[model samples]
Target: MNLSRPLLLASNSPRRKELLASLGLTFEVRVKEVSEDFPDTLKREEVAEFLASHKADAYKEDLQEEALITADTIVCLDDKILNKPASAEEAYAMLRALSGQTHEVITGVCVLMKEGKTVFHDSTTVYFKELTDAEINYYIQHYKPFDKAGAYGIQEWIGMIGIEKIEGTYFNVVGLPVQKLYENLVQLKIVV
Candidate 1:
């Protein structure tokens, strides 16, 4: 596909930008603050996907003839959704809650086409080994993963030393599901 249309990424996440760059696709970043709130009635995955689609809708007017990509990721453990922490204390609390447990990292992506077509969402499971107070404290103090969901980055020291296993895409835990995004892009003929 030799498309000349530009691609727009509607997010301020550096990780998502870097992940998309890895695909060698030319794109421009357009960050718009959208409410991340979702109805409490929605389940875990539905909540995530709903937010993602809502983000995409915020950029609809700016889409032009290009495809716009928007996404939302959440960490779920025992039906609880863990988003980015509001403070250092919250971050610490989230990490402590995740210690020695398996969690689901669900990423909802909305790829909006120029012709009004769209596709979205993917989920990955990650497991963390039991972490001591020292381990969690050290990681919180050092990494300070305030911008990441679940208060941790899978590519950081915590994941290196604390994650025991993962059942799905590693990139999904990082932020975006590149493989799934690529497949959808291909189907949309957005990239060769």
Candidate 2:
């Protein structure tokens, strides 16, 4: 259902934009530069929501009638957060650590309105098949997933062959927990 007010998505991720579009909601992409930094004291599960909340804070004064949406995603292994890789080598190392292991993908979403704000998160367990050294190298060179958390994309080639299983929402692994986001939007009356 169309909303009474405009929807503003404060993210530059094409994946997130596409996911929101798939829900049949009309929105405007209003990019804002928000740092991904979080307190070192924050737990792995809390980091994403903290960051997403910060993203919303950056535009709190500008929320006229537009409901704003922001999100953050992270990959966790053994309680350690794996953010986007800065280099191909880092991506390879992150992927190697994930090989044959079950890791967690968490995404935090924030929906802010002039009246109130909602912040929440969803996590998924991803199991990867044992990957050969050559396979890791080839994937890094071919897919260039340095921008994605966990050094990989669940919808990309590495995910198709490397990811053995997932225990939660697949879209959460892709960077946005769209199902939960949709539910929150409806609850907040952003969509009918």
Q: CA lDDT of each candidate?
A: 0.89, 0.92
lDDT tens per residue, model 2, 1-192: 688689999999999999999999999999877778889999877898998999999999998999999999999998899989999989999999999999999999999998988999999999999999998999999999988998999999899999989999999999899989988888888797
Q: Worst 10-residue stretch by lDDT in candidate 1?
A: 113-122
Candidate 1 per-residue lDDT, tens place, 1-192, comes to 344578889989889999998888889898888999999999888987899899888877766788888999999998999989988899989999999899999999888865775656788889899999999889989998999999999999999999999999999999899999998888887886
Off by more than 4 A, model 1: 1-4
Report how far off residue 36 is in candidate 2 (Å).
1.3
Cα lDDT of model 1 overall?
A: 0.89
Please state the error at residue 65 of candidate 2 in Å: 0.4
Candidate that scores best on lDDT:
2
User: In the order shown, what is each candidate's alpha-carbon RMSD?
Assistant: 1.3, 0.8
